[model samples]
Target: MTDWNGAALEKIAAAEELDLAPERPNGTLRDPVTMWMVRAGHRPYVRSVKGSDGPWYRGTQSR
Candidate 1:
């Protein structure tokens, strides 16, 4: 099975289930998956290294 967390699902779902109307606003942009990660003390995974993950950029090493 997928390693997805259920409580996170509930939180995001609650936001999705809001009954906003034409004259009303939607809701919080803070998605539960994100918030859950935050509450769990997790961080958004880095997408990729901008350049090299080498210390050379910081003047600590040579290429």
Candidate 2:
């Protein structure tokens, strides 16, 4: 899809499409958080911590 001026309109369409993506429930952007952690002397490896009292908390849970 090209504009009236014969310019390639691919960039404009892609930007609008990204804006309609699903929302994140964390109330903050994940990408920025990951990047900041990387720059702040944090290790690249990560893991999840949870309580085992509930039935959902199993020892074999996977990321």
Candidate 3:
């Protein structure tokens, strides 16, 4: 897997949110969902406000 570079990580750290579209089993992207992002050290993390029950989160599981 490709890792995030320093510049990319820095840009992500400065952002408050991101749009995610998980790919479906048929290899198509689902609708984009806007969610908050958190930076812990050099790592970035995100979650749905509705937790695992969220449609976007559930979409991610399909892959």
Candidate 4:
């Protein structure tokens, strides 16, 4: 596995403090709507706000 630098880790930690969620790099804002994000230790995780049946969720399953 790859390791995270202190700055990257801190940035992620700070992002977790906000209610805003970042958009997918390749996705348009209106396409998937809101995303829910969280940090566990040094790792980040994201989930579709629309749940497992959401378009974003379905897209991930196919890949």
Highest lDDT: which candidate?
A: 3
Candidate 4 segments exceeding 4 Å error: 1-3, 16-32
- Candidates 1 and 4 compared by TM-score, better number: 4
RMSD (Å) of each candidate, 1 decimal? 15.4, 15.1, 2.1, 4.3
Least well predicted 10-residue stretch by lDDT in candidate 2: 32-41
Q: Provide the TM-score for each candidate, comma-separated.
A: 0.21, 0.16, 0.74, 0.57
lDDT of 3 at 31: 84
Better of 1 and 4 by lDDT: 4
> How would you encode candidate 1's per-residue C-alpha lDDT over 1-63 as one tens digit per residue?
243367754454444223222221344332212111122222221111222462222322341
Q: Name the better of 2 and 4 by TM-score.
A: 4
Worst 10 residues of 1 by lDDT: 30-39
lDDT of 2 by residue, 1-63 (tens): 222222333333223222222224656533311111111122122222223442223422532
TM-score for candidate 2, please give it: 0.16
Q: Is candidate 2 or candidate 3 better by TM-score?
A: 3
- Quote the lDDT for 50 in model 1: 26
TM-score order of candidates, best first?
Answer: 3, 4, 1, 2
Say which candidate scores most in TM-score.
3
lDDT of each: 0.30, 0.26, 0.80, 0.63
Arrange candidates, best lDDT first.
3, 4, 1, 2
